[model samples]
Target: MSIAKRLASQTAIYGVSSIVGRVLNTLLVPVYTARFAAAEYGIVTGLYAYVAFLNVVFTYGMETTYFRFANRPDTDRRELYSRVMTLLLLSSALLTTVLALLARPLMSLLSLPPGHERYALWIALILGLDAVAAIPFARLRLENKARKFAAIRLANILLNVGLNLFFIVFCPDVLAGKYLAGLRPLVEGLYDPTIGVGYVFISNLAASAFTLLLLGRELLDFRPQLTLAPLRPLLQYAYPIMLMGLAGMVNETLDRILLPRWLPEGFYPGKSNLAAVGIYGACYKISILMSLVIQAFKYAAEPFFFGQSNDKNSPRTFALVLKWFTLCCAMLFVGVSVNVELVARVFLQRPEYLEGLAVVPVLLLANLFLGVYWNLSVWFKLTDKTYYGTYIGFAGAVLTVALNFLLIPLLGYMGSALATLACYFLMAALCWWLGERHFPVPYPVARLLAWLALAVGVVALSWWLPVAEGWPRYGLQALLTLGFVGLVGVVEGRRLRTI
Candidate 1:
């Protein structure tokens, strides 16, 4: 198969679980926004921000390392995977045990009250299991089992979503032996009435364990040959990558963690901190559709790029991929941002969070820049100059933190929006500059600017069109999305048609 076809297949595989799964997950946003107040939802937001941070730390860049080493000619693929999985299992088990022992103190350190300590425990276990499962999943990708990769992903997400709906929508009244059939007697016997929040974690835990069960074949492939001598270089390579993950996560999640600390006092009298986080977070989910698309592209790109690093046409091909990715994401940005009111209404199901509508465009655009930055990031990763990623990520993290501190107090969550944009843009420029020094890819600078120009024009026209609410706005935006594709087809269609 052609690399492009392989890329498309892998992307679709990743996308099925990511984009489709997330689209299903989006169902919960409406439920959550409607069921919980912005303040209540803010707690969820803050908790999950910590989840994102913890996730990056637990995995510690091992997935990418797996892809790198597993592709090498001399590496014994199964043994390498077995060793990696062993290392992850031992480390994650030790960490999980230690964290469970110290859960209460860690909760307190994270500023959670005693009552929320169990939340810490549940998520820690979830993250640990996820960390251990990472290598098998990467093996699936390496073997080109895109269907299985996507299937497992979709199954996990579906389980989580289905359980959430059952708990939140059905557990309260219907399962009290009231009306719902097949209702587990367990719900009535030992369950607290108000443990809807806890059920979220329980569902995730169940699904995570199930995911591990599905990896039985991969797990059985583990050999006892996993020893310390062979792992030293991998760990050395991974340490900086882990730090880069940490820094990148901060840029992505700091706003959720810091809004409570940095919001101006009396911002909304009694309902300030969590409310701000909740609103920002709800609107944030609306923007995540773009991020999911970027992630799908990354999954397809990482292995492909790493393998193709030595090819003569690799630079030009990489440049075109970046161009295409940017144009496609730009279309998404304009489509979603221009008619956001419709999306906001359907996504949130709560009128109260409309305040965050203004931040959505900025967040989406920020995500587009971040996606572009990611494509550029491969230069350093391929050349083993990955220290550059760590440096850029560290700088971006500082920018994220400083901006949150400076602007959240003044402009509220919107400050975080601006800060995120600034940080991503800065990193994109910095990475491009540095990567050019080490490995120059001939990215179409002028044509790429034209694509952005086209997106700006499309958004301007949409804004001026005055579609007048409801279906009209969405209808016009849909047309604009299609029209942008048609326009792209006209400009670059023939070039892309070859393969």
Candidate 2:
């Protein structure tokens, strides 16, 4: 198969798991918004923001390191996998224990109520299970076990969704005598309504444990090695990646983390800062449509790029990847941004959650740039100058923090959205400039920018046209979205045919 074809197939399989699974997960947003007040859901959002940061620390970049070393010509793949898994297991255990011990203090620091320390503890276990499972999942990708990977991921999502529905929806209804009156006693024994949003964490923890169990075949060959000799070089290479991951998380999530703390009381009129955080978080899910595509591409592209590093035409292949990636993202940016109100209405059940819908376009564009940065990052990774990624990530992190601090007081979450857009745009631009200096790829920079600009223009026109609501607005958006896709087809028809 052609490189593009193979990557597409792999990405499609991964996308089935990521895109479909996340779509199912996204469906729970209505349930969450319906059942819990914005402040209650804010706890879920805030805790998960911390989870994103800790996940990087727990896995410590071993997944990418595994791909790098395992692709080396002289390395023993089995030994490398075993050592990586062993290191991950030990570190995850140590980290989880420390986190569990400090759960109460951390809860206080996170601004949670006095009695919610168990939330932190649950988060600790979830992170440890996910961290330890990282290598086995990465191993499947390296081995081209995309089907197995997709199946397990989908199963995990399905189970989480099932458990969430059972706890958050079914049990409460049963207890209320909505149905299955005889099961009320059984439900009462198992379910606590006061647990409320805690069920989100519980459902996730159960899913993580179940996923780890499902990967037993991958872990069958694992043997613990306490000695650091085999892991020393890997650690040397991976620590920078961990730092980069941490900094990247700052750029990606620090806004959500800082919004509630930094924003003044009564900033949004009748909403607490925590409620605003909840609104921002729920609206942010609308932008995940773009991120889902990026994530699926990342899953496939990382290994593909490394394996193709030695190919003569690899630069062109990389260029083609970015070209198509940007084009598709442009379509998504236009499509989702134009119909954002309709999308928001569907996903966010509460009218209050719709307050932050203004941030969706900015965030969609931000995530597009993030995906572009990921593509450009293959340069540093392939060159083994991964520290360059660290520098770039920290640069973006600093900018994100500075921008958030400066703008949150002025424009609220819109300011946060703008900060994200600026951070990702800077990172993508900087990565491209540095990649050209060290390892040039013939990326179609002007064309890609044109596509993005066109997308933005289309979205602006869709909004500015002042069409009436209902089918008319929907029809116009549909026409404009389809129009953009059609233009891309005409422009790239020959290239598409060849591919």
Model 2 clashing residue pairs (backbone): none
lDDT of 2 at 406: 97
User: Which stretches in model 2 have alpha-carbon errors above 4 Å?
Assistant: none
For model 2 the TM-score comes to 0.99
lDDT of 2 by residue, 353-412 (tens): 988888999999999999999999999999899999999999999999999999999999
lDDT of 1 by residue, 1-499 (tens): 8878878878887899888887887778998887678877877788788888878878888888888787778998888888888889888988787767877876664465568778778988998999888989888878878788888888889999998887777766566556765665766674565654677688888889999998888878887556689998788778778898999888898888888887877885666777878999999999998998998887778888988977999998899888878978987888787778778778887777887788888898889989999999988878777788999999999999999899988888899999999999888989999988899989887788788878878877876786576687778888987888788889888887975
Model 1 CA deviation exceeding 4 Å by range: 109-111, 175-186, 460-482
Weakest 10 consecutive residues of candidate 2 by summed lDDT? 221-230
lDDT of 1: 0.83
